[model samples]
Target: MTTPVLYLFGSAAPPVADVAGVITDAQHRGFDVCLGLTPTAARWLAPQLTELERLTGHPVRSEYKMPGTPDVWPKADVIALAPATFNTVNSWALGLTHDFVVGVVAEGIGKRIPTVTMPCVNAAYVQHRQFERSVSELRSMGVRVLYGEDGFQPNQPGQGHPSEYPWHLVLEAAVEMHQG
Candidate 1:
C-alpha cells in the first residue's frame, strides 16, 4: 500500500518553530508529510523554508494559488493541524477561508478527510467565549479537535512550554482515523 499523505498545517504559534521535528516524526510514522503554514508562520520560518522543503520533499505552501492553478501537493489522506492559533480555529469554524491553511481545512471537512486539530493557545485566549464555541462547532462537524485537559491544556500567558505541546496525540489520532 502507498504511504498515507498527511497534510500537516500549522499557525503562528510558539510550537510552530518546532515543525521540522513534527514533520520528521510524521515521516517515521509512515506518512508522507506535506507542510502548510499560515502567512505569519511562513514569515516566521522564512529562513528555514528551503530546508523544510528538502525535509518534506514538497513545497511548503502558505498562500492560495491563483485561480485555475493546479494544486501542487498530492491529495491528503489525513490532515493534522497543530499549534492552531485562536484566529485559525475561529476562522475555520466560521468557514472564513481567507487563508490557504484555513481554507483547505474547512474544505477538508466537506471532503470527509480524517482531520484533527490541536490548539496551541493560552488560558487567556480560552476565556474568550468564541474559542470554546468554535471548538464545539468543529467537533460537531466530525473534526477531531484535540483541546482542553485531555490535549494541549492551555497554560497561563507567558508560561507556555511550546516544546511540551502534545504533538504525539495529534499524530496518533490522525493515524488512527486514517486506519479506520
Candidate 2:
C-alpha cells in the first residue's frame, strides 16, 4: 500500500522555525511529505532548503511553475498549512492566488480536498475584523481550521515562541480529517 501524500504548506510566521520538526513528525506518522512555502517563508527558510529537501525527498516549492510544466510533487491526499500567517489566511479566504502557497491551498479547497490550517497569528492580528471572518469562511468551505483556544490561541503581539507552536496538532488534524 502507498503512504498518504501530505502537502505541507507554510507561511512566514514564528512557528515556521519548527518546520523541519513538523515534517519529521508527519513522516513518523506515515505521511510522505511535500513542502510548499509562501515567498516570505521561502526567504525565511532559505538557509535550510537543502536539508529540508533531503528530509522530505522532494523539492521545496515557493513559486508557480511555467504553464504546461509538469508538477514535481505528487498529488496530495491531504494538505496542512501550519504556521499559517494572518495574511495567508485572509488571502485564502478571499480567493486570492497571488502567491504559490495561497494559490494551491485555494485550489485545494475548490477540489474539496481534506485540508487543515493552523494559524500562527498574534493577539494584535487576531483582533482584526477580518481574521474571524476568514476562519469562518475557511471552515464553511469544509476546510478544518484549527484556531481559537483549543487549537491556536493568539499570543501577545511579538511574544510568540516558535517552540510552543502546536506543530503536532496540525498533522493530527489533517490525518483525522482524511480518515473521517
Candidate 3:
C-alpha cells in the first residue's frame, strides 16, 4: 500500500524556522510530505530548500505553475497549514487566491478535502475582529481550525516564542484526519 500524501502549507511565521523538523516528523509518521510555502515563507526558508527537497524527495513549491504545465507533486490525501499567520487566515477566509498557498487551500476546501490549519498569531492579532470570524468561517467550511485551548492559544502581544509554536499538534491533527 502507498503511504498517504500530506501537502504541508507554511506561512511566514517565526515557527516556520522549525518546518524542517515538522517534515522529518511527518516522514517518521509514515507520510509522504510535500511542502508549499507562502511567498514570504519561501523566502524565509530559501536557504534550506535543497535540504528540504532531499528530506522529502520532492521540490518545495511557493508559486503557481503556468497554464499547461503539469503538476510535479502528488495529489494530497490531507492538507496541513501550520504556522498559519493572521494574514493567511484572513486571506483564506476572504477567498483570496492571490498566492499559491492560499489558492491550493481554497481549492482543497472546495474539493472537501480534509484540511487542518494551526494559526501562529500573537494575542494582538487574535484581538482583531476578523481573526475570530475567519476561524469561524474556516470551521463552517469543514476545515479543522486548530485554535483555542485544545490547540493553539494566542501568546501575549509581542511575546510569542517561535520555538513554542506547537508544530506537532498540527501534524498530529493532520495525521488523525488522514487515518480516520
Best by the TM-score measure: 1
Model 2 residue 52 CA deviation in Å: 0.6
| Model 2 TM-score on a 0 to 1 scale | 0.98
Tens digit of per-residue lDDT, candidate 2, span 81-130? 98899999999999999999899999998787899999999998988999
**Which ten-residue region of model 2 has the weakest summed lDDT?**
149-158
How well does each candidate superpose onto the true structure, as a TM-score? 0.98, 0.98, 0.98
Report the lDDT tens digits of candidate 3 across residue range 20-67. Answer: 999999999899999999999999999999999999999899999999
lDDT of 1 by residue, 1-180 (tens): 899999999999999999999999999999999999999999999999999999999999999988999989999999999989999999999999999999999999999999999999899999999999999999999999998767889999999988899899999999899999
Q: After superposition, how far is residue 107 of candidate 3 from its true place, in Å?
A: 0.3
In the order shown, what is each candidate's alpha-carbon RMSD? 0.7, 0.8, 0.8
- In model 2, state the lDDT of residue 70: 98
| Stretch of 10 with least lDDT, candidate 3 | 157-166
Reference-based lDDT, each prediction: 0.95, 0.92, 0.93
Show where candidate 3 strays beyond 4 Å: none
After superposing candidate 1 on the true structure, give the runs of residues whose Cα lies further than 4 Å from its correct spot.
none
